[model samples]
Target: SRILLQDTSAVPTSPWTHFVMMAGSTLRKVKSRSWKKQRHFRLLEDGMTIWYKSRWAGKGHSTFSVTEVEAVREGHQSEVLLSIAEEFPADLCFTLVFHGRQGNLDLVADSPEEAQAWIQGVRKLIHKVQTMDEKERLDQWVWDWFQKADKNKDGKMNFKEVRKLLKMMNVDMNEDHALHLFTMADKSESGSLEIEQFVHFYKILTQRDEVWKVFQDYSGDGEKLMLEELENFLMMGQQEGERSAQLAQELIDSYEPSESGAMSLDGFQKYLCSQEGSIFKPEQRDLHQDMSQPLSHYFISSSHNTYLLEDQLRGQSSLEAYIQALKRGCRCVEVDCWDGSDGEPIVYHGHTLTSKILFKDVISTVKEYAFKASDFPVILSLENHCGVEQQTIMAEHLSQILGDMLLTTVLDGQVPQQLPSPQELKGKILLKAKKIGGLEDCIDETLTDEVSDEEEANGDAESPSAEDPPAESLTENDKVKPRKSKSKLSKELSDLVLYCKSVHFHGFEQARLHGKCYEMSSFSESKAKRLAKEAGTDFVQYNTRQLSRIYPSGLRTDSSNYNPQDMWNVGCQIVALNFQTAGLEMDLSDGLFRQNGGCGYVLKPDFMRDGNTQFSPEKPEERPDYKPLRLSIQVISGQQLPKVNQKEGSIVDPLVRVEIYGVPQDQAKEETSHINNNGFNPVWNETLNFILHTPELTLVRFVVEDYDKASRNDFIGQFTLPFTCIQAGYRHIHLLSKDGTPIPPSSIFVNISISELT
Candidate 1:
């Protein structure tokens, strides 16, 4: 039969329905937290199973269609099709869609001569599919569908018949999608698809089927289940048969002391509270019954599909409550920290929140909490809500309390020459660049005035935690004018580079820099390169838009994208020792790092940090909300959590909100306890694997649990982690699962080493 191709242009009436049917029976559903995407899809009745993705080493490709073919035969079929297409004559042309962004390919072969050229192009496509192992899996599935469309029991399929067959099979199978599949499949332009064509089409349908199944499973009975339903379901199999009845009676007895014979949800929950049988007990269930523990590895990249949690611990004080919250499994934590003008560090994240309490009181309160600093496992980002001096003072104070658990980060040259602890060098504190308005101009002033006073008085000029610089002193001429504030660009940049250089000079891993600037676009690539060369720094930060301008350009010899006239504009290499870019995008092209010849950008860690901005009333009506000091952190479990303790192929837990700063230390400390479905599992004894990814903390004590294999010799012994930012190496460790797998632990120790790179 002669084939006729037709194109249709309307949204599929039942995309989900059609997708489910096409994916096949095995796949359960297509579930994600992001908006779903739809593209033109084809429904080929041809017996050929289309291969879309690869699976396994060599099943040749996993065929999803009911049709079966020998592995050796399929391999030879693939070869023959590719070889014949190279010389077979065929006509090829593409049709432009009016107002359409994507052009449709139309290969018109009126005679054998033109058909031959078309076949050559087809050969290239076949060869490409053969070379990709993943594509093999896809090809096999497509072939299956083609086999089914061969209604005459013949080995070949024509589009005219295939289209009719798809309509009967409940697939829209319109002309455009069908013709696209056919054109790509028919290498010889004989206007007919041999068995190979069927194979490729089958693969495409199979994947659609799999994804459809997932969507249905997640949709669940066409009803949106409530939280209560989910909770009850989790307790379903916990207590079975007579034992369940006995527990129920016990619960009633505890609450119905007065013998009402009826109980409320609260009463029922309370009365049934036996450690051995309580439904709320962690051992009773996993996080949620429907959500199984993820088996994938760490999430090394960021995307819209990723999940983000909200800050829950808004107001609370009981350290116990905080600990319980942590046990609840949150990946992020925040705490209010203060630098008591006395150069003492206090754990508080706000200016107003701690106004009533002395910094020392905050410290003393933190000491009373049951959990030590080591118990918390998250990157602690601080906001210098307190002035820059206090932030520095607090850093010093924290350096002492945290010891090896702190990580230090300095942008350019803001840090001092010597720090007290080797743990500081380990990667605990970040000497981030705090760009003052017009900070560049303020540098000389900050150095000549602030630095001079501090040096002369050894930073004793003002109380390290002085509240406000006396508002009256801020009136225009008191120091530097607001508009005159400079970038602090050169100093901060140089400080980061110099610090990295100094640390590296000591034969240690180069210390990293946690660079920050509101206007990242202003942070040019040339400046960054110079900083890298001068200071030997690692890790730089950029917002989305800024990164696009600096993404490397591989071949800009004479392209409009770059100026070939300037060598610096062409073949630029933007290396991110440990780079991450966040914020707004100028365009989609900006987000494609690979296209620009650069590694991808990492999403900002959804963690808590201290934030401070002094606001002035420019006008009477411009008054803003007087927000007390506010600080928060992000926590993850198996999804957002950085790779720390994990099985070889298991997924990294999510980043949840386990704790927060600005709250009382006890409250902040308490948030970490209730994680991983209650009583923490001490199976993976591993430290956070990618410390450099978070260049903020100066010292870190990674508390991972090792499955107790009943062996005393479970430790992996001590090792060292050397980074570019810190010259001295931080001690590395493996708190392995008793069996050697990395897992969560009750607690562990980490020391931050901070010193000049050299």
Candidate 2:
């Protein structure tokens, strides 16, 4: 029986405490940089460091931090060949590459299980290190402040010292209020404030004002809100089924233990900032959206090079990539198919040293995990390089695995004049590939007699032509050339292309004239941007009826992604992004799709969907009736700002940037003044304003950055909300990490106001 090796690296597991024996060899330097063997490696310090013994007896051992390690399971040694000698089971061997201050260390494990264990242990330690680093920074910050405020070299601060510290923090407290706080903190009657008391006092001071402001906004009666008003506020924007007066009353009863049947400011604050009171409004999960519109009318969460987890050149491709992308609500996935050994088609990068997985396995995986995240249709963007025989095998695997879930024919027949809505094909998987259809028929008819005679003379045998060569037989040099061959899709495969038949995009005019339902075209990011610039209005008009996909250009070999909003601005539905990457681009993508229940589909704006509306990225002046809105934001201060690194005495010069993302003409941004040398309680009493035209479709993002004069500014935290959902008046903006999870106890206090122009 084959040993099973499940990919669990991406899955979160408890940190490992015990160590397992593992034999690995590391590369050491004999002279300047000559490679020499160093044997007998042991994972030490709970897998936080690796210590390897020198070859010489009684020699000193060198250690490297596991946090800097990069480990990967070895796949096929050769890309062009499929021989057993070059292929090894992933469970048998793996490699580890470590980057450290001394230099780089490359090592290889003797067994796969051992490598897997080491990698898992190292990852756990890395996470633990990061957590510890954060805690240590906070501790240091407390100590630094305590030492500074402890006048006369004392261990604690008296009321005068505490008052001085408050002043330094830009906080103003009346004498009576300060005395009350000092008395409350001096629990032991020592008449001095310790580090713990100081920290607790600061938290209370920051949280009180925020709570009162929120209460005043919701409680129209000024002091408190009635039970009915509190219930309405809690159930705001919730669907009718979810909004229950009883539930709201229960929440009020839990927070407000008063006989007056009213929620006080303190009670409201506790409920609003608690885990139960999420900033994101509750949305109904059922398909309540207008499913009658064509699939082209929705923006899809898509992935470019779905198999790659790193750089395109030598990144490892595995089934886990597919699983991760699918679980993240990616509706469209790419599969580069080529002929594999043993009559099975394989999926991988065509000419790189990347490993391959059986085409059938990919199909089976997709079938199992396709609808796990979303019930909407999945589009398999097939880049076929397989012969007719292997293509048939690929089709058989798909049909057998997916069964009736695979859309094999047009829904309701009648040659759909418009594409079917997502509701019409909920659990279906659509294949987007070139097929022998209308355009192919025209091309076949237009073929010159000389070419037809040559084909007839060869007895119509499917031999290897320059256009369709055996992919495996091509050498590295030959693979460099473009392999743009007409797909010889078999009847079985062509029949599966129900609603995503791939077509080459000619120009704006040609696509508008000849495009039909289920006929989709794709363009590289550069080409799409050029078309948008050159023919913005025509392109927008063309997308109203047909679907178009925009992918990253081949020049983005580093697996970096372009700003998908640029493509989205022109109303392109499927703007593919490199999901493996994490940056501003991916953040925007996540923010956009985070709406609509994160169902991997967002309905296109009404202006873009209307055929009669003449929308152009270039000619925003033409829309005379577009109302403009003035937005004013006051950046006040931040509470418990997170430390970016573990270094002591490190201070953050924080600045708040407000960005408005929408159409080209509607975009606007502004930044508040920076506060120097303060991560904890940095205050910038500056107001930034912007005039936005398309406020309804705009996204307002607040990004906090730590400014540095000698280096690039580092991201502190950020939060993005749709302009429509932003609440005005004094609001406590919760900061979120790069992955959109809220950072607890870290928030920014701000005032927002919006006014519409006549």
Candidate 3:
């Protein structure tokens, strides 16, 4: 009954669809206020494409598929549309945001109803495209090729045209096999194949023999899989446990083409390509980890210099940088505060040519977006180089702008043995800076104190926030500038710093004896790495009670990042990276924080969470929970990979690189040989092996690169997931662009198997 209601139901049609199909409309295309020109736009008869051209003879027309559009904003929500808001009303404006890096197209209508019709009409079309199943998407891709290959615009394609289409689709097919399939699909004997017939030819051409073999092994006959057979297959083949029966029935109902209790070949294929069939486990996509532990018991996502959008030397600082960082689930951000030439304190690199903005503005932006992505606490790591006067101003702005969200004192008015948990301070922002004495010493009087910057343990550092000079602005003589560690502190600013007090680091023995739970220390990457290597278990014990921050080295003037896995291996809570940079380091950081609902605080493994833990990152095999997992991955094929360089005429020669990042013993990389000249759909059936000593903190990265013997290989796309969240089966790993945005229809299919490494 439920299946009948879902299958044979009538969907009500909207009037906007009729309006878009019948009479075309003329709208003003907006680039800027001065470039608003009249253009005639109409929806194609297929309702899957939109065509637009200027109202002049010289202006050529252009058509774009409905699948290209990502979304439609109903009002002036874009920068371009907002720029020309004085001339156009907000209700009359709409923007079409396209997939990938395509620029948005803004348009204005004469009437509100016309704008409403186009907005709703385009939304309906986008919904239809998004709801298409795997088989329908495959058919659409083939039908689009047929339409492009049929130059005469006829409704049919001849054998010669079909043969040409094969080459265009990156298929090096045999001529005899192509002719045989074409003749079989040409059922009307009209010497040509229609759109439906071409789709049939595609189904036969791309049939999965491996999938058929598995299905036949489980099915009673050879065609369909009943509930019992499907459940059995789910348990044995997909690595599902007691829930396999419910999961199998749900998959059949959701993916089966018809209203039947049994699953067919098409339905099974769709289920295998769905999210359940993806490499990452579905449960890990939500908040499934414990959040009631102390703040030091989790690995927090942190940013090194969150205000810079480019090179740290002379990059432009904007509020958008803070917004972007917070939206990407960065729980901790660094702010370098210096006394401005004006009365207000400003934010920028201390001794560089980087641009500055008002400190209040940064606080305001942080206030607006602090909880946008994650509700857990956000730590504002303040590098204060301001005098007592401007420091008071910075304190006022922080308290006023971040009104109720700031953690002014200890959580719950109690100083516990350990710090508060993320759940205890969900919507709060914690300030990490130099304090006068401690949390309870908030006296209402100014004090003269020696306020030197926390010198890095590297022994040659300039300052804590050594946001060094321009990329190449170092003088030959004074490599290490003189330091003045004396300044005045006001009671107003000092009171705001409760928890997360910045302190200097003595040796490990001194820290173990005197370090308070609320006191934290920042270490340079080189120093932290040396400490981890020298005393791995001690560093892990220190992090069990107090938070430690690891930042990039000062020599990185280009704002490049160092791999954070070494720091994280020692159970460091906040390993900061240049969030503005996109590379392998940031990829590992994002991957580690991507689990636990992406709340930006992933709990440490059990062995690393105990203060008396004897587990050493350098020797993870000594831990009790160190059961190694033998991971075997078969790189099967690539499907619809985007070309590395879209402008070049040559197709890409692609190769796949699978990498594992964890303890030193588990870190490894393997690559497949390059396919000569195909980026569209290349298949390489190669298997790679990895043995993970500590699978709890492991991350697997899949990178696709276009191989080039002439120069360095160009990057195509990459996807990374935590090893514990990986699913075992024949799964598709959806690819993401270099900046971590999805490119539609671009994925890699692989078969994964894992067992206990005895």
Give the best candidate by lDDT: 3
Judge candidate 1 at residue 685 and give its lDDT: 19
lDDT order, best first, reads 3, 2, 1
> Which lDDT tens digits does candidate 3 get at residues 529-594?
888888899999999999999888778889999999999999999899988888898888878887
For residue 187, give model 3's deviation from the true position in Å.
Answer: 4.2
- Give the clash count for each candidate: 221, 0, 1
Better of 1 and 2 by TM-score: 2
Task: Give the Cα lDDT of each candidate.
Answer: 0.27, 0.66, 0.80
For all predicted structures, in order, the TM-scores are 0.20, 0.69, 0.83
How do the residues 335-447 of candidate 1 rate in per-residue lDDT, one tens digit apiece?
34444556554443232221222333322223332122223222222223354555545544455554543333332435332212212232222222223232343334443
Candidate 2 runs further than 4 Å off: 1-206, 213-251, 257-260, 274-288, 438-487
User: Which ranges of candidate 3 are over 4 A from the true structure?
Assistant: 1-168, 187-194, 338-345, 349-358, 443-482, 645-652, 677-681
Displacement of residue 309 (Cα, Å) in model 3 is: 3.2
Q: lDDT by residue for model 2 over 300-324, one digit each (tens)? A: 8998888877767777776657766
Ten contiguous residues with the weakest lDDT in model 1 = 293-302
Model 2 reaches what TM-score against the true structure? Answer: 0.69
